[model samples]
Target: MPKGEGKVLAQNRKASHDYIILDTIEAGMVLTGTEIKSVRKAKINLKDGYASIRNGEVFLQNVHISPFEQGNIFNHDPLRTRKLLLHKKQIKYLIEETKTTGVTLVPLRVYLKNGVAKVLIGLAKGKKSYDKRDALKQKDMKREIDRAMKER
Candidate 1:
């Protein structure tokens, strides 16, 4: 199966608008019991999530996994940083690629594959304001074309 073929729990819609994705990789997440439960219920947010490599490991930051409703004191923190599991070779490649200016690792989507949570991270470069405008214009034009074709 493809990297993000399973049921998606949360998607970072703004990530694509703000950055141009160059490549993507799938990595497993280390989640606590409660956190996994919340994720399974689709109570997760990836709006401000980003990945950073630290000491040769990658950590996901700013992603919010809401506390499980039925959980008591054992519920995990909603914004706790989580570790991402990736191969050493993949990590090395990410390190080299991210060393370039303006390049970053952003979590694009989170999904469950084979009952395990996986994150699809993208290697992206920031998009300028004008680039965003151009993309919007292109989308509008495509929409108009599709509308015209549909009416014919």
Candidate 2:
């Protein structure tokens, strides 16, 4: 299917408001058994999650996958860092892109695709306070226009 097509389990709504997403990449996640179970249950928190490239590899940090209820002793840590699977070329590009100031890698959403867990990571640039206000104004205008059109 198309990129990011799947049942979205969790989304970081604040990420969109805090940063301007320039591009997105879908990457598979390496999860333990219990971790996958938790993900399937939609017990995941993408807030405070970010991707970092280290030692030529990408890792997802601060994403909380709640421990499975029935996993008992087999439950994995809720906030453990998870490895992200991306091609070598993609990693290289990300490494280069993130080197720029104010640019960051933020997890936009988590979804299940074909029974596998994937994370949609966005290349984002931080929004200034004025930029945020402008965005809000634009959204309000768009909403007003849509409402007027719908009532016509």
Candidate 3:
């Protein structure tokens, strides 16, 4: 990775398998001091996390940032809902877009950029059972093709 492209702290790999991501947006996170320290160490889980528009603002829910071990008394709540900082226009657009049926917001990954914590949020539509199966089949086929080419 190059400079300015910070390290990824955590990712929700299952999001891609379950939803067809239509678009992605990067937003900043409001973190406490210790929480940011924990995030730097990659002590976070995005597997069960999601984003929502609440009270005209965006918030992240279910994402867990483990408490800083050294800061026993000042540790932040591991699973507290964190506010996402986005422009008013962006928030309004997401609110309108998510109103359509079958569309929702999900957190794809968390990373540190320029010493700030940011989240990559995706606008996604859920995949059906058959769609998932078809994707799995295609992936398997692609893997086989790559393997065969490697041996040649």
Candidate 4:
């Protein structure tokens, strides 16, 4: 983070390497007290997780939110499907766009924004192996240029 910038609670590193994120949408998570407590510790994983729109609402699937250690029996499920809160219009748009061929709704990151937990969902399209290699090439080229400039 830049100096004085807001602290980042968590990030999904796999999302950047695997998916081609075309657009981002912020959605609120419906979390219980125990779940929120685990999030505060940054004990969360958005890797291998996905979001889907169903019946005009969104739900996150397969995300691992480590159970709150102190709560016995009442601890939130580690892999429960959590509902996402989004505006009606935004939900509608996401549903429509994701329904198109080769596109999916991928959860990018989960973080606290201004005291509220928000998920940065991405409108993504899967990349083939060649496409991934091409992306890596571009990134490597840019890094090389930066290194060259720094040593000058």
Candidate 5:
């Protein structure tokens, strides 16, 4: 596929910073017509979106799929919870892992795959304050090293 033609819609960069992702799964979302159109226009946000299992089903909440500009009063809510289409086995496994480890399910990305909308969801555990600080320090160290190497 061409680079610009096959573009990514939205991503959650903060999820990696705030949590340690242990597993990732690709799932489909149930979107309305206007929502799909809005997504095609790249009007979406997944930063605050998260996934959760309810009664054995998976749902995504806080994700913003902006309303289609041409739509009137029929537009779907931007932050409404959307159902995630995951396999039964995958859902079951995530539920078990979350229950055992007290981890969470966060939406890592929302993009198109082979012309279909797909969401990359991660199984993660929240990081401690020190862990975030350590990560920042490491990032700074790497930046400095890269600069030194370029100057050498």
Candidate 6:
């Protein structure tokens, strides 16, 4: 599939507001049958979710994919940790980057591309209160500029 093309299922909208994203990579997810079905229905939440490197593999934690209603006894856990599929080289790079102070792996969004589940993970650094305020100010200024231009 082409880059950045997908049917988005869930997004962490607060990620941009709370963190300074440095880079992003799309990685595939390992999902169960019921979990995938739930994801296709957009019953997923990325808020409070993050990725971590464990034993040389990346795993996504805190992401919630509700069990499929029709799954019955075969349903997967809604809050189970899921593995993220990425190349060894990419995992190594992320491991090194995450070792730095304040650097973290945050899941920005989840989507389906070419009928496969994918997640957009971002390398981020925490933003201080002042940084958030500055961002809000810049957004307000941009909106005002756009409004003024429209009035012209």
To one decimal, what is the Cα RMSD in angstroms of model 3 from the true structure? Answer: 1.7
Give the per-residue lDDT of model 5 (tens digit) for 1-152. Answer: 22323457888999989999899888889999999989888899998888989988999999988889899988999999999999999998998898967599999877787777888889999999999999999999999999999999
* lDDT (tens digit, per residue) of candidate 6 on 10-69: 989999999999989889999999999999999999999999999999999999999899
Point out where model 2 deviates above 4 Å.
Answer: 1-4
- TM-scores, one per candidate: 0.97, 0.96, 0.95, 0.92, 0.93, 0.96
lDDT value, candidate 1, whole model: 0.95
Model 1 is weakest, by summed lDDT over 10 consecutive residues, at: 1-10
lDDT of 4 by residue, 63-151 (tens): 99999999788898899999999999999899889888989888887777777778888999888889889989999999999999999
Q: Could you give me the TM-score of model 4 versus the true structure?
A: 0.92
Indicate whether candidate 1 or candidate 2 has the larger TM-score: 1
lDDT: which is higher, 1 or 2?
1
Please identify which of the two predictions, 2 or 4, would achieve the higher lDDT against the true structure: 2
Q: What range of 10 consecutive residues in model 5 has the weakest lDDT sum?
A: 1-10
Sorting all predicted structures by TM-score, with the top scorer first, yields: 1, 6, 2, 3, 5, 4
Question: What are the per-residue Cα lDDT tens digits for candidate 1 across 31-132?
Answer: 999999999999999998899999999999999999999999999999999999999999999999999999999999889998899999999999999999
Which tens-of-lDDT digit does each residue in 10-126 have in candidate 3? 889999999999988889999999999999999999988889898999999999999999988998999999999999999999998999999999999888898899899999999
lDDT of 6 at 26: 89
lDDT per model, in order? 0.95, 0.94, 0.92, 0.86, 0.88, 0.94
Off by over 4 Å in 3: 1-4
- Give the winner by lDDT: 3 or 5: 3
